[model samples]
Target chain A: MTTTAQTRAHDAANLGLLPIFMAAAAGLTLLYFTGFAQASVYHDSAHDTRHTLAFPCH
Target chain B: MTTRIFASALFAGLLAGLVAVLLQWSLMEKLILEGEEYETGAKSHFAGVLKLNEDGETAEQAAESGDGGEEEGTTRRFALAFFATFVTWVGWALLMVAGFALTERYGVRITMKDALVWGTAGFGAIHVMTGIGLPPELPGQPAAEIELRQMWWITTAATAVIGFALMGYGRKPFHFAAGIALLIAPHLIGAPRLDDYSGMAPPELSGEYVARSYAVAFISWIVLGLAAGYFWNRLQQPPA
Candidate 1:
């Protein structure tokens, strides 16, 4: 019983797919806005950063 | 568990973002600002010599007509720069943490030491691989269309990430072979480019910008890896 309980605890400690997917989605959105967004406002605001980070920019 | 993962990512991401902003301020900001002078025609690469535009006006005259638009206030510009850098690093951190968690689920052990390796891999995928085609550009550097370049950049980074992940996690020889192919495929497709390599900024300035950008990115990624690894380990521990 103790071995089974411990095994269950260990498995629970590992992360699930949902949270990982959510994090990835959020990250991609933020990266897209900061690095790749083409709006002139975004381009103007992030001009120097776009250059420094090597993002494609005018 | 989900909350804990996000909390850890937030803390680590913010910390790394702060480091990246400070590094950018010190190392790269001046060069960018200087390059902008050329970009805006506030300064000319040819010094005293005047270049006539297609309209037959001198470059200086065209600049005086306000073609480049008004410069943003210094404070506002600085704020924007800081915000962009912070957002970028946070995004990268979240991705890294997610990667760590996913890999752990797949029977890979994620120690603080391993996180550093992960961080380096992130840098390799995002910067080094993409850089081979695009390199880095200065303000006035001639380039292909933004949309085309952006698409290529996204594709390259994506392929590199998947390629690296497969190589790192895959069990079969076929997986590794596929990973290598993915890594090479983007470069084989090539990045969008222009026929001419012309730019208003001096070649020396552009060269310096590329070199410094890579150096700053490397340091930031290393710091990000260390901080994320430390936090990931710390947060995973059960309360005493």
Candidate 2:
């Protein structure tokens, strides 16, 4: 029972790094589109929001 | 666990984003639209006072002129704003949740209170720290080149984030001092700036816009923190 508890604790702590990396990648991509994309369409579309959120905008 | 984290992030982000967009529409959109009038020359600051038109047309008179086919454009813009804001919040949520997970791996469990602290750190890094060099701007506000400003803004935010992380996690005095230094380094380097400060919009209007934007951002970020924390706790509970 002690061994099982230890193993469960180990597994719980070992939540792995992959999810963190994947989430970071996805998050950065979305942020780029909303806040930093240079395309005129993106700019025009997100103009007010970009300004409202204090993102750099034309 | 991964799926749970993502699910928590998505739900929290959606809730926060909804609140943020509603707040934006009610509190901030009008200032932006008014600023755009100056930006597009639909209303001119000088024209209003000087009566620049041959027919003595004031800026208010010019503004009174309506644009055609704006209904379609307004609808499109509104849709875009909604989507962008939602995406932005989700992105923030994902990043924050990932941070939470990473910290947990190092033996730091994030409670709802801890999540609120993280959210404040986020606001400090992304909004307050960056805004020190680059305050919120109106549509017609003068600025440096976009690329340069963006580079500085990103650098400041990254440094601030790292700095905050160190301060939060580091046990040593050196580490804390290093974090403080990192926090100050970007400001010391300075943000890119225009040679002259001239804007189409009046200064009072611009001031109000900046103030209101910060107010809105603060409230939204607090809500985001609470929502993220609540969801994070809710999802992490063991199945009954």
Candidate 3:
């Protein structure tokens, strides 16, 4: 019984799928705006950011 | 645990954002404004061709008039820039902190020094890898289709990140080879390009913009990694 409980605790402590998936989603959302969003939407803002951070957008 | 990580990330993010905004205000803002001036036709690279005024005014007088517009406001631009920088840094900090927790959970030893390395790798994957294909562009610059550029940028950054991960964490020789392959994969499939290179801004302006942009990015990422690591380490420890 103790062994089983310990195993369950270990699994719970492991970094699981949810955080990883959420991070990916957040990353992709940012990426869309930074790299792929329509220029008409936020072109100036993105353009300024691209230059400030030096992301090669040209 | 999540709250602690986020708190650490938010703190680091705010600090990094401040650094980015200050640097941008001091270093890059002028270059961008000049590029815009050319893009909007307020200035011209090619000489000898007079800017014809619909009002039949002198070229110099017309140029002066062109400067006034809905788009012309330093205050607005700076405000927007500050907000964007802050949010962006916060996002990055969250990712960095999460990465630290993930690594720790996976049994890898993490340290402040290691975080610095992580920061460099982040810089490489996010900026250097993608930038290899698409260096910073300025206003009035011609570009290929946005869809294609986006596809390539995502592919490059993804592959680069995977490559770095494998190389850093994989223990086997095959893993190393696989990591190397991933690193080269994006470059092998070159980035999309325009059939022609053209932009209203002068070449010198673009060059300066690219150089300065890289310089600032390199410095900022280093700081971000260090700060994130320091904060995460401090926050995660039990009180004495």
Error of 1 at B182 (Å): 1.0
* Candidate 1, B1-240: lDDT as tens digits: 577567777888888789778878988889988887777666678878665655666656776775454455766887998898888888998899888888778768688778888788888999999999999888778899888999999999999999988898889999999999999999998999988767888888888999999988888888888888888878775844
Q: Candidate 3 lDDT, tens digit per residue, B111-226?
A: 98898998899889888888888887776687887678778887887788789888988899889889889888888888888878768788998998888887777777888889
What TM-score, over all chains together, does every model reach?
0.88, 0.90, 0.86
Candidate closest to the true structure, highest lDDT: 2
- Of the true interface contacts, each candidate retains a share of 0.79, 0.76, 0.30
Clashing pairs in 1: none
lDDT of 2: 0.85
Candidate with more favorable, higher DockQ: 1 or 3: 1
Q: Which 10-residue span in candidate 3 chain B carries the lowest summed lDDT?
A: B50-59
Candidate 2: regions farther than 4 A off:
A1-14, B47-67, B237-240
Q: Candidate 1, TM-score vs. the true structure?
A: 0.88
Task: List DockQ, one per candidate, in order.
Answer: 0.73, 0.73, 0.42
